[model samples]
Target: MALRVDGDSPQNFSALFDLRGTADTGELRLTSPIGSTLGLARWSPAEAVLDNGSRTYRFDTAGELIRAATGADIPLDALFSWLAGQDKSVPGWRADLSQVDAGRINAWRDSPLPRAELRVIFDTP
Candidate 1:
């Protein structure tokens, strides 16, 4: 999957996802050259889950998670930032993150470091 954010808006972002692989135990194990084996993502028609062992993230099909494991509401920017920081090999889209609501920003501030598992959502072209 490829994600592109245009302008300073998270809503302006575009995601392209290409899924391949078999489903096992309600999980879709995809192998993409852009991702790592440690990255395990599971998705169903209603929800998406990403588990990296220490942290588990659950998001709606719309790519919005009600709350992170830290009990914090991760803003769109911080979420992308945290994800970008994980694998440096990912493209340079990190520079596009924009300011979000203060309430959302505070959720991730001073929070415990996230586990290696990073869950992302993309629109299938």
Candidate 2:
């Protein structure tokens, strides 16, 4: 996932995430841009774990772990649906799906502070 958050501190974070499981049980592995293993995040209804290289970080929720790692307030679950071309509405954000057929997605946040935009382009596999 290549995420660029432009607001107070402009952050360009790109990671490879393998997401597996349902709402009750799920695991997500995040890798560096060069494909080196960065961390493995596993979560169930009652537990969440983030194993980074030599250290392990635990959080109350997957969202918290993700936020701590990425420093961006992104809606992970909704993002999966969005990438699938679903029109999921995240509060304070709006997406443009008109060009999704062209392998592109553009979204922006207008409320709760500095305005930011997110653009995603899927590479042909």
Candidate 3:
């Protein structure tokens, strides 16, 4: 596992993920120096569960079952668009879509229900 910032290599890094359960599920939580959650990816291999808190999203990755759950063939672009739209309601939250690289975009575009990005911003009190 690696962490990058603004497309540059990260100077500091930390992460927590557990893969010991029978469900084969794990959660990754990473925070940058600026106090923003750079990434959070979770998956349940047993049940094909996927979720990312930054975007308030939850979905299953159980093959065709996921499509059935959503009632549609959801594309990666649509998922990212949906996640981006969610930031609109978050008072201090913002996402820099421009910073997303081609590799990242392609990876998600190719996956059935890929991980979502969340670039959090902190506001002064």
Candidate 4:
């Protein structure tokens, strides 16, 4: 995922996500190319948490947790659906499903300022 802030608070980052678990509850671990852990995001029905080894933060929802961590509000539900080739729609975002058969997907958030993009490439079983 690539996050870019368009205004005065401009920021950018791209991380490879090691995502696991179900739609309702799961853990997402972000890491650098050299195997250094950047952070871990965990969510359950009760709450959501982000742990950066040295500090821990909590939020009311997974969306909030992700927003705090990435400077973007990404819809986790729609993200999972897109990965599964479900063509779920996320407001302010557009998903390209043309390459799902090749195990790849691309989604972009073009509005509400600070445009962002997400790409997923999965192993074909």
Q: Say which candidate scores most in TM-score.
A: 4
Q: Considering TM-score, where higher is better, how would the candidates rank from best to worst?
A: 4, 2, 1, 3
Clashing pairs in 1: none
What is the per-residue lDDT of model 3 for residues 17-101, given as tens digits with 9 covering 90 to 100?
Answer: 2222221344434555566665444546544443433344455543333343233233322323433432222222234334233
Worst 10 residues of 1 by lDDT: 101-110
The CA lDDT at 29 in model 3 is 49
Task: List per-candidate RMSD values in Å.
Answer: 14.1, 2.9, 15.2, 1.7
Q: What overall lDDT goes with each candidate model?
A: 0.36, 0.73, 0.34, 0.82
Cα displacement (Å) at residue 23, model 1: 12
Can you rank all candidates by lDDT, best first?
4, 2, 1, 3
* Cα-based RMSD of candidate 3: 15.2
Model 3 residue runs over 4 Å out of place are: 1-23, 46-54, 62-125
Clashing pairs in 2: none
Per-model TM against the reference = 0.28, 0.74, 0.26, 0.88
Question: What 10-residue stretch in candidate 4 is worst by lDDT?
Answer: 1-10
lDDT of 2: 0.73
Ranking 1 against 3 by lDDT, winner: 1
CA deviation > 4 Å runs, candidate 1:
9-35, 52-54, 62-125
| Per-residue lDDT over 1-125 for candidate 2, one digit per residue giving the tens place of the 0 to 100 score | 56666677877866766667854478877787788997898877677788988999888887887678766666666666666788999999888887777777787777655555667666522
Q: Give the runs in model 4 whose Cα sits over 4 Å from its true position.
A: none
lDDT of 4 by residue, 1-125 (tens): 55555556777777777888865899999888788899999998899999998999999889889888878778899988887889998789999989988988888888877777777776645
Give per-residue CA lDDT, model 1, range 1-125, as digits (tens). 22222223322111233334322223434344555444456655677687755687778641343233223233433444433332222222222222232111111122232212223543312
